[model samples]
Target: MVDDTLLETRHLTKEFAGFVAVNDVSLRVRRGTIHALIGPNGAGKTTVFNLLTRFLPATHGQILYRGEDITHARPAEVARRGLVRSFQISAVFPNLTVLENVRVALQRKLGTSFHFWQSERSLDALDERATELLAQVDLASHRELLAVELPYGRKRALELATTLALEPELLLLDEPTQGMGHEDVGRVTALIQRVARDRTVLMVEHNLSVVADLSHVITVLARGSVLAEGPYADISRDRQVLEAYIGSAEPEAAV
Candidate 1:
């Protein structure tokens, strides 16, 4: 079947011991759109991401990617199918230069024979592509710095560049701007927007402005279930959503 939906979850549920983290939650992400998942703390947003990426097995339910059930797929299997995730913390090798980090990711995608044993000149073959990815993430100037030496925002950019090197069809971003200042947030937001031009992005983001600006669809989760789903304007005005945020006894900020 020619599926217009890039991703879907059917009655997805997750329970730890006797406690349910995600309870019969379902989602549909259309191809070529930025989808945002927003919620208060303990809302099971991270658990949903883990289930989709196969980091955690669902207590019950199914996950479909491009119409195929990925409920039992391995993390590597999902990633090979072009579903990649960028973590809240940067995922670059702290000791490696920004350029080298991207080069390594490109190598993983290429799977060259005896890749680790290949000469520096052979590895140089990936430099051009790595350079382009770095530029895309606005890390071109920091390409030579060790990943750990770069500023927090730039480290995130480098992680993004590495992820981009893999050319994922569906990108799962966890808090793309979690700890950034205003300037870095704007920079990362622009970078994400630019990258989503040709790919589908499903992001778990807290910043309402970023969510409102980038998402074509927004799904709000409260108490581990979908409370509302729509565009920013519609979801923003939802009475249930407003009440859910307001009712959070844990003092969470929500949009």
Candidate 2:
């Protein structure tokens, strides 16, 4: 039988000077499942992401992708290995049209990322695949618009489109729905669901509604440690999760 785990962290820890941001956290993300890392303020959720992506070197621990230890992998190396991430803020180029932005991402796979000086016709081959990605995120009609002109929710969709252009095996999303009203939240949530159908996703999200809807497994962190781990059904009733995260209105707004 094949091993189903796609990503795993063992004894992961990160420190800043003398401050412990993430403390000995170990997690396993099974293949093709949506896993959410959630917590209240200062729970070290983003710190864990930084560690996983190799933005910060771990003080102690291990990061494993497909069962290989990757504790010291560089950010670019990690991304090249089929693990990609989207940010909390919109990351598309403001002046570029949605199609152009996605086409730029596709250029990475062709090994011509800095060839913008080339003829426009040279990159036209990517247009068809770019359009398919746009349609996947429901942004096909907005393909001609500059990314800056899109509404915030639509901008996020375009960013997702660009990320998909890289063909990631495991997508890491940081607060994908932050700062959105109910309508945009619903749209992005559905978009995440659609995109997650083919690959695995690990996200740090504050919105319980989105976490409840999409997460197959939920990990709760508190004070830089794992406080709970289980499905949403079990996590919802976890007394510690309720007291530390869900019971407070402010926590829902946390990043």
Candidate 3:
């Protein structure tokens, strides 16, 4: 029988020098869903990403993708299996033109990445694919511009386009809208919703509104453990979640 789960973890734990950064956290992500992980600073959100992507070795437990164990797979090996991550910080080639940045990513996906000496024009298929991705992210207008020269928000879009070039089944976004203005945040939110139409997205987002607007399921983490996990409405009203992460309200003085 085909496994229904796209990703699952069993007692997933990560430790640093005897300090448990992530403690026995188990999660299941269904295929083709947008799942959001939310928490305050230092709540082990990034640590979870590191462990899942194999940037850091798991102190214990198992990570399974499509019912197969992948706890100790190397980062590239994990990515090759169709799981890819976008870092919280923008990853782009600053000196390269926006089109060039995405073209390089497309080349990697097409198995022609080693052809460094060949002219980019020789890879017509890669160029075409990259152009399509640029359009999808609404960065086609800035194609010839230096990646560093584009506005901050557009830079994020460029990063998204680059990740798309990899053709991932699961996209891990680490604060995709961080450090953006209101308008930019709205744009990125819409872009994410568009992307989620076809791919599963697992994100660690601090922006409450973004989480409420984009997430189909929300998992709350506090002090290295799950405080709550459910649909938005259920988790939002959870008293334990409110007190531990959202803070309790103080009584107002009589008017």
Candidate 4:
């Protein structure tokens, strides 16, 4: 792997029974850049995510992170090594206050054991860092609200805060703007751009506008294979990409 590459997948393949979901895919994510994986639904975008995060084991191929092969690393192990995935839904604990959700994640990152009997002061030490994370995602104002009470956009912001608390070197986001209103989409788009400044982000986003705006590189997948790969402008013009979305809502590739 090149020093500039944060992640690479070599001949990455996944099979379910006899179906090949991702077939011999090789990907390189440059350090400190935002890369997007876009395709029409069922193009194996999420399956690729599952393989990378080890949510599902790859049938074949290798996953390399920071030049180290982690093909067989467990999900927790991958997360511990600084590759973290944000689920499709916000992963915040609904009953916990926004501040507490981030605090708990920070504690987990620090390898602090849960101690029901521990003094409150130990947890208080986390407030400063947690507040900083919340501020990073523009959730500082809602720190006192329960996670369940946040509006959809704010809840997603809270989820991003918790993900950031892990201090991941590589972040995988699944449909960050899905189900969001236009206003919320713009906000999260800006938030993603801000957080990705110092880390590598690989995201699967259905919103082509957001992908075009934020992606330094875009890879288009079709039928479990890479159909096109390049800057947003170039991939947008690829004839193969346009045809792949023909009968469905177009990918807005021209964006």
Candidate 5:
């Protein structure tokens, strides 16, 4: 059975100073599946993310979320439509405690006024929700710790928890496992898989093994155009994909 599409790009293109970064590329992400975008450095993976999230306006294209055109929607509007992205680098508030950071996210999700004089009791429910999110990311023990004090891997986990607080229907991750130890990578890989069970995920990942392990669909990009796309096994073995992106290395276990 064909899966329903949750997000899609039609002829998505981005150009700067007459140089195209992403060229007329169309992609679809199935609802409740993990879709991975892989390519060498400068293949325009990040550019595509920016376009989808409206961080960067498309040169010419349409972005559709749940079949509604949101081509020029603001980032927050897109997010409110159940599309949220986590950056490669951590975006946590360094001075805020882990629980506080999650609480802020929950408040945003709840659409509460940001006035300082708002009743503290109003946020109690948000705090409880935040605590539940921290537990999901395995950071319940560090809830009182400052965001900057946590180790890098834990920081990444916290970022995921914050994104989850948004209650996204489609999640975009940028190099989620970047700069992590092998064990940390494995842990994050598992977390991403668990999240994918509920929300559709689209990621720009450099780690071939992670893509192979998590992606139900793989789209290979080279020089701003799609080189190949299919199941991991087929795309990983395609001659053009290997020559243009994957190179000569044997596939490694997902980690």
Candidate 6:
């Protein structure tokens, strides 16, 4: 059988001072799907994300992207392989305008990233593509404003736009909706849906509603191990998943 998985982790584990944070967790994120990693506080969700992006070295196991072991790869190497993580690599300059922030990412494709002496026309050439990326994240109208000038929620939107500029095949989002107001959450939820039409997304989100709405597969982590894995309907009713969330094993307590 052919492997449709875009990202896979095998026996992945992490430790800090002999305390295991992620224990033998394996994930299979298929192509063109939204996969959510969720759990209660201190379940090692972010640690798993850091491991996948190479921000933190795993104490054991393997990471496979496009069927190749990336266990020892550098952060830039993982990103260059088309597995990009938002907020880590997306350079959102506070002083630059929204469009300009995205233009910086686009400049890499033009091979003029380090050419400080490049002409204004060379940089301006990125404007059209940058504008399109802004449009993708519903930031077109705010393109002229400095990233710092935008409201908190729109600033996150700009970050999303800049990440999209890299044309990633697999996007890893760590709490894409954290610290947002209700309106901002809705808007970003919609934006995630829009951008995920073509590429796959592997996200660590705390918002169960957003996870239920966006994720094609959900992996529930508890005490540094996978408690359960399935659709939201199944995971939500799981006793173990419920106990991990609310400290009660009542199946109806809701995940």
Q: For candidate 6, write residues 1-255 as lDDT tens digits.
A: 988999999999999999999999998999999999988878898999899999999999999999999999999889888998875233479998888899988987787889988677779878888989988888899888988898878888888887888889999898888878889999999999999999999998888888989999999998899889999899988987867878634232256
In model 5, what is the error at residue 147, expressed in angstroms? Answer: 1.0
User: Model 1: per-residue lDDT, tens digit, 183-213?
Assistant: 9999999999999999999999988889999
Identify the superior model by TM-score, candidate 4 or candidate 6: 4
Off by over 4 Å in 6: 88-91, 247-254
lDDT value for model 4: 0.91
Ranking by lDDT: 2, 4, 1, 5, 6, 3
- How do the predictions measure up, each by TM-score? 0.95, 0.97, 0.94, 0.96, 0.93, 0.94
Candidate number with the higher TM-score (2 or 4): 2
Per-residue C-alpha lDDT of model 2 across residues 1-255, encoded as one tens digit per residue: 988999999999988889999999999999999999999879999999989999899999999999998899899999999999999999999999999999999999999999768899999899999999999999999989999999999999999999999999999999999989999999999999999999999999989889999999999999899999999899888887777854556646332
Query: How far off is residue 234 in model 5, in Å?
Result: 0.5
Name the runs in model 4 displaced over 4 angstroms. 249-255
Q: What is the overall TM-score of model 1 with all chains considered together? A: 0.95
- List residue ranges in candidate 3 displaced over 4 A: 1-3, 246-255
Query: Cα lDDT of model 1 overall?
Result: 0.90
lDDT: which candidate is best?
Answer: 2
RMSD of every candidate to native, in Å, equals 1.9, 1.7, 3.9, 1.6, 2.6, 2.8
Q: Could you tally the backbone clashes for each prediction?
A: 0, 0, 0, 0, 0, 0
Error of 3 at 51 (Å): 0.7
Tens-digit lDDT track for model 5 on 97-183?
999889888887567847678887878888778888888888999999999999899999999999999999999999999988898
| Model 1, residue 241: C-alpha shift (Å) | 0.6
Worst 10 residues of 6 by lDDT: 246-255
lDDT of candidate model 5 versus the reference: 0.88
Where is the poorest 10-residue window by lDDT in model 2? 246-255
Model 3: lDDT of residue 110? 66
Query: What lDDT score is found at residue 227 in candidate 3?
Result: 79
**Would you list the clashing residue pairs of candidate 2?**
none
